[model samples]
Target: MFDSYSISELGSIFVMQGFAGLILFSVYLLMALGLAIIFGQMGVINMAHGEFMILGAYVTYFTSQAFQHFLPALFPAYFFVAMALAFVASGTLGMIVEWGLIRHLYKRPLDTLLATWGLSLILQQVYRSVFGPREVGVELPAWMMGSLKLTDTIEVQINGLFVMTLTVIITAVVAVMMFRSRWGMQVRAVVLNRMMASAVGINTERVDRLTFGIGCGIAGVAGSAFTMIGSTGPTAGQLYIVDTFLVVVFGGAQSLIGTILSALSISQTQSTLEFFLSGSIAKVITLLGVVGILMLRPQGLFTLKVRR
Candidate 1:
């Protein structure tokens, strides 16, 4: 497949595709971080997670429109507001869902998955009714629009770089929150031994709710980031949900480092393959490879060793 390109051309292709993969990696990491916390850490199978992301995208859309219509001069600053609002909107809804439904299905993974899937459909219909069937794209600020030309054959997008930077910052913050914060310690304690943690004066229920909310909140931020790369539609989340889940699972679900590595690996592989083959074929080959590896090591690329 590479025989068609000269050595320099191949080098440029790899470089460009590698950068493209970084953007994909950023999104996958953002989406999977929440899933890792919920599914990997809390053992909750949240099928409606994508809808939560879409909610954030929609929030960003509205935030942009408001800024454009009401505060055109400050449009460049609207993104920060949009991200914060998206996080709050999605996180608040997550907390509500926990109280109304997820809390009831804690012990039943299948039930939670089915319930969330139903919720996803409901959310999609609502989005369609409100936003219409057509996909929407966010307008970029002047600073966000263009690419940096490194050479005749190599250019990098400003937005892509921003996504990478944002991903890194968020990942660092999440890692610190998961490991260093007192709330994180409580969550770890609760996950390790709910009854013991409760006896030790930790509120397991509160931790569960907060953890779920935070996970969904991260998804919201991820969705905001997605608008830079793709158009938002009611069902756009569905397109990425499977890939996000796969990255989480292929990494050790409970390991944040594992999720990052898995996302990076899967994204680069698929992106590079896409340059040489069709998108669908690239995805198929990548998935098949992942499946083959999983057949040999079901525990995934990395796993936390804990006594059950």
Candidate 2:
């Protein structure tokens, strides 16, 4: 890869790729954050998580269409409304799933996995039926359509910047909610000891419902950001599900900082490698590296003290 490019050209390539990696990092972090809560904290193997993300994507697509048709003057601000609606829609579905299905299979991890997998298939068909099988792209507002001229050789995408900024804001909010709020306290208490938490007047059931809902809601926001970078399809969300799980697992699922770090490392490595190698090859190499490290430290990059 380095044999053909001059030193200056290589530097420019690296700079450009690094920025590209940051955009990928934002997506991975958002997806992994939600998975960390659902799979890590709740111990539920939700294979349908990606379906929930697609649901959000579809919601955003429809919202954009509605705004364009009925409120063209407000179309520039439609994304904010779409994202909020996405969160609400996905979160509501998650709570319903929790109450109707997941709540019954709490301790049966294998069953939850199988059940959610089936649910994913059902959701995909539903999306295909409703939205058609064609992939759909969102229309960006003029402000999000341009690029920022950082240097003669390096132009940064305006939409990428917006997505990254949104990611930072969401991550910060999640951190505060998880660590500083009363709900955070209740969530931690339930995670540590459900019976003890309930004895202390904490509603463990409610905590479980809200935790799952919030996690899915975050995934919804991720889907909204995703529309900026790629087209939405019934199966589009599946493309990132495995990668998101890897980030969560490799980072120590219970640690948000670990998730952030893992996403950064994986995203940068894969992004740079893909420039020189085939996308599949780049992914294989990244997966191999993660696996090698995990062989020695199965607990992951970071760990938290939890009661047995």
Candidate 3:
């Protein structure tokens, strides 16, 4: 296949692949960032992370429906409202779970995993009962249902660009909240030493709830963004969970910089392979490669030096 293509044609293909890789990186980072905050910062394994994303997707779907039926003039702009609602809906559920179940299991990290896993199943069933088993297609506005012509031979989907932009904005805002603000300091302190943070007058419980809520909220945003590229269903979240976990763990828990780097590396590698191979083979190769490397450095790519 390569022998027939001219150099310029190959270059264009490579560029297109790179763009696709970047979009994939953005999506992965968005999904993993929330999990990182919950597991890495709060030491809680939120198995319902994918469900939270599904909630967001559902919210976006409903928003689109409402706009199309009742507010046709605002069809294109419904996405903004949908995004906000998804964040609130998922964040509220996260806070509720934290208070109702997670709070009791704070000292028992392993139990939280089981509890959240059960919650995930419950949520999935509820979604299935309400939405049925079939996937719901999200309707995009006319303005968003097109592609941008980058060059004579290369064109990119507008939705991909939208997701990339959303990812950048969310990353910047989260970075600022995690590193530059007083709440961020408290969050870091709590992650570093929970007992010491409590001793120093930090409200550890509040921090925990907020951190988890933020994580879920980010997942919701990711789901909303994903409506452009994938299906919306109860099980849609399951598709991304494994990859999300891979990014979070491989990037190193509690390290935003590490998450971004790992997501970029994994996405680029997987996307490139996908261009030449089937999706399943590409995923298997990526997972095996990550597993092999992680076996050598169990602490991941960027281990924090805080005393445990």
What's the lDDT for residue 223 in model 3?
86
Of candidates 3 and 2, the better by TM-score:
2
Please give the CA lDDT of all the candidate structures. 0.92, 0.91, 0.89
Model 3 agreement with the true structure over 1-308: per-residue lDDT tens digits? 47877888888888888889988898789899899888888888888899999999999998899999999998889999999999999899989888899989988999988998899999999999998889988888888778989889888888888989999999999999999989889999998789999999999999989888889999999889888888899988988888888999999987899899999989988988887779989989999999998999787789868565
Estimate, for each residue in 132-214, the C-alpha lDDT of model 2 and write its tens digit: 99999999888899898987888899999999999999999999999999998898888778789999999889999999999
The TM-scores of all predictions, comma-separated, are 0.98, 0.98, 0.95
- Residue-level lDDT for 47 in candidate 2: 88
In candidate 3, stretches whose alpha carbon ends up further than 4 angstroms from where it belongs are 1-4, 305-308
Better of 1 and 3 by TM-score: 1
Off by over 4 Å in 2: 305-308
Candidate whose lDDT is highest: 1
TM-score of 1: 0.98
Taking all chains together, the TM-score of candidate 2 against the true structure is 0.98
